[model samples]
Every structure is written in structure tokens, then in C-alpha cells.
Target: MSTFTENAPGVAEQSPEAAAGFTLNHSMLRVKDPERSLHFYTHVFGMRLLRKLDFPEMQFTLYFLTRLLPEDSVPEDPDERTVWTFSQRGLLELTHNWGTEDDPDFAYHNGNDAPQGFGHICFSVPNLESATTWFEDMGVEFVKRPGTGKMPNIAFVKDPDGYWIEIVQPDLTAGLGR
Candidate 1:
């Protein structure tokens, strides 16, 4: 069986100096309905909308969101807000193509069916059990419930766009003795 090692054949080596100050800014997902997608993200995930940009010429819009801690401060100026939004980690970008919501047959491929490629995004919670219970109460759709799958502690929930959102506690692997 093939397994990955530190110096694996396909691994690209990077020095600390070369990779400094690099952070995952965001991962984007296309949504059909901005209203429903925004509601699900902000209400269900408790993420605040950081910025929204509209492109009339391109006929689409982009919504940037992030989960802000109580201590985090948001800039009031538009330019400063843009800078602040880009610097934060774990941002979610929702892209909406105009008029997709109006078409009854329109749907984005969720990457879970046949010919799959893109996978799920995850969120770490303080308590897995409580989070799953809260998700249940909020009428969120579950792709898999905790304790039912091979990895019993993890759960998968769907966003308004049907993209999977993995739910896990911070100590997930530690408890498994990995």
C-alpha cells in the first residue's frame, strides 16, 4: 500500500522563510440563491457578513463572511474593511451568478454525486454533541450524524446550497488516540 511520507515523491518542499505569513484566506462556493445562502451561513453558522461586492457588468455578486470572536473589531471605512476582511483566516466566499435563483432548473453541482471532485468544508466546535443537537433543532439537514458513521465523533451537515459542512470538535483525533 502506498502511504505519504515527509519526503514523498509528490510532496513539494517549502522552507519556513519561503512560506512565512501565508494563510488560507478563503474557499469559495457558488450558490443559486443569495438570500437563502446568506441566511443559512449567517444564522445557522453564526458567521457575520464582512463584505459584499456587486458586479453589474459581470452580472454576479460576492459575499464574504467570517466568524468573528467578541474581541475582534471591524473597521467602519470601506477600504479598511476590505483590508481587514482579506487578512482574517477561515473566510467563506459565496458567489452568486445573477438570475440563477429565478430559473427553476438551475442548480450547482455539489461535488458529492458521480464524477465528484470538490469536497466539504469543516468547522470546529467546542462541543460536538451539543453542536449536533443545536443543528438538529435549527432544522439543518444532516448528511451524516455523529455516532452513526465509522468516525463516530464527526458529523456532516449541508448548507443551503447542498454543499457539505463537516462538524468536528477540536480534540477529535486526540480522543481517538491518534
Candidate 2:
């Protein structure tokens, strides 16, 4: 393994002063079919649709979804829900460009192909075995299965748009023998 030298060049600074009020809000991905994408995310991954905004002028729509814990309370009012959704973390934003679903060849690069870029989004399930079994029963495609890969405790599933979603159990990963 290579260690960082004293004068090692950096792409970004490691200064907290430059990021005072910063927090990771969400990550966005473009989907070809909004309906299929929404169904896959909601039913398969168990994410709730927090908010959706349609822009007729731009010919696009934005769908924001998040995993709401059992103890979390969602506000009833639209204004309150909007504020609460934005203030929370681990949100997933899906962008649908209007008319793309009509084009049979329309597909977004999943960023894990030849020229790899963005890899995947992950979810930490309470039980790895049960979660993977549930995913298998739902007919979800798997890129990597737990106990088959170098990291036995982690698995990867593909969404409708072919984007990878890594699944792991927090307790199991601690004993990976790293």
C-alpha cells in the first residue's frame, strides 16, 4: 500500500473552514422511464416518494425519494413536508427527461461500464440474508451476490435504469477480515 507523502498533491483541500454548513444533500441520476424507475425504487428498495416537481418548460421532471424510518413522522402539510424532506439526509433524486421514454434507444450510462465513473448507491439493511432473499423473490437483477464476492457480506443489485445499488448489513461488515 502507498502512503501519502508530506507534499502529496491533492485534488481538493482538506479544510473544514471552507465547508462550514455543508452536508451531503442527495445524488441525482437520470432515468429513461419515470414510471418503471419510480416503481423499482419504491417497491423494490422500499423508498417513499417525498416530492415531485414537473417543469413543462424544461421538459423534465424531478422525483425525490427517501427511506423513512418507522419512528420518523412526516408532516401533513405540503409546505412542512417540503421543508422536512430537504432538511433530512440520504435522499435520492431521479431526473426524468420528458419524451425519453418514447425513444426505444434512450438509455443513460450507468457509470460502471467501459469508462467507469460513478459506481453505485448503497443501502445498509438490518439483515443481509433476509434482504437479499427478499430482493431475489422480487426478481431484482443482481450484479454481485453476498458470500460470492471478495467481500462476502456485501451484495449489489441493479435498478430498472441499470444503476447499481449496493446492499450491506452494518453488523456483518465489521468482521470482513480486512
Candidate 3:
């Protein structure tokens, strides 16, 4: 990895040059079951279904999810929606291969168990108490419940695929090193 510093070898110590702005389009997760993943993200994390793409020949499907702001609205026209969805940022992309979900023994490594690589994703909520209570009612899997982990203020929940997701309160994240 390359590091940019004010006092690196031949680099000047003066102010750095400005760069163009860019948005984080999306982060993808391959899912064995689209229905299960969609349910967890939309219901538990409060994300909206932005767009869906299906590749019949490739035997795969892609689902795009994003948390909708109060002021945001879904466009009705296909062209407009496509343009709008691609332009937005902070999206979670769920990809599903056609036959994987139905196979009893087939499963994707959720980056937590053996052969680990990726860690976990996060969601910041307005009220942690309310969110926990709701999750309790919904019977969601809890990898690390609130006030139980190292950070008593943060919580971790697991999706259907056993993917750990950290849940944080916006105001309390400061102590958790947001």
C-alpha cells in the first residue's frame, strides 16, 4: 500500500493538491439464498430494494439495496430509476447464483468461521434500544448482543447466511471509534 505524507522523501511538505470527488457505489456480498438475504437486509437493517438484475444464461442474480432517506423517492420510470440507482452511493449489492440456495449442503463462507477473509458490515441506528427490542421480537440471530461484547454499547447480529453485522448507535459510535 502506498502512503501519502507531507514529508515523504522528495515530496514537498507544503499543502497537498486537491483531487476530484467520488462516491462509493456499492459493496457486494455473494449470497446462497436471495430471499433470505433480502429479508434480513430490508427488514432488519431497514434497507430498500433499489434495483435487481437477473442473468438467466449466467444463472445468477444481483440485488441492490440502500437505506432510503426521508427525502428520497423511488423513480417510477425504468430508465430514470436505473440512472438514479447507479448515481447513488453507499449501496449493498447482494448476488445470488441460481441453484446454490436450493442445495442443502452448499453454503458460502460468511467470513466469520473457518477460512476467514472478510470481517463484517455495519449499520448505524438512531436508537439502539428500540432496534434491539425489534430484533428480539423478530428472532434475529445475535452473534454479540449489546452490552455483552468488548464495547458494551455496540451490538452484532447475524443474518441468515451467518454473516456478522455490527450494529451501532450514531451517538455512541464516538467511543467505539466510529
Q: lDDT of all predictions, in order shown?
A: 0.90, 0.89, 0.85
Task: Quote the lDDT for 45 in model 2.
Answer: 84
Clashes of 3: 0
Clashing pairs in 1: none
| 26-75 per-residue lDDT for model 3 (tens digits) | 88899988998898888877889989988999999989999998999889
Candidate ranking under TM-score, highest first, comes to: 1, 2, 3
lDDT of 1 at 97: 97
| Segments in model 2 whose C-alpha atoms lie over 4 Å from true places | 1-15, 175-177
Best by lDDT: 1
Q: Output the lDDT of residue 137, model 3.
A: 92
- Please write out the lDDT profile of model 2 over residues 1-178, one tens digit for every residue: 2333444477343445666667677899999999999999999888999988889999999999998889999999888988887888879999999999999998899999979999999999999999999999999999999989689889999999899999989988886664
Question: Could you tell me which 10 consecutive residues in candidate 3 have the lowest summed lDDT?
Answer: 13-22
Per-model TM-score on C-alpha atoms: 0.90, 0.87, 0.85
lDDT tens digits by residue: candidate 1, 1-178: 2233567576755545667678899999999999999999898889999999899999999999999989999999988999999998889999999999999999998899778989899999999999998999999999999989688888999998789999989787575634
On TM-score, the leading prediction is 1
List where candidate 1 sits over 4 angstroms from the true fold: 1-9, 16-19, 175-178
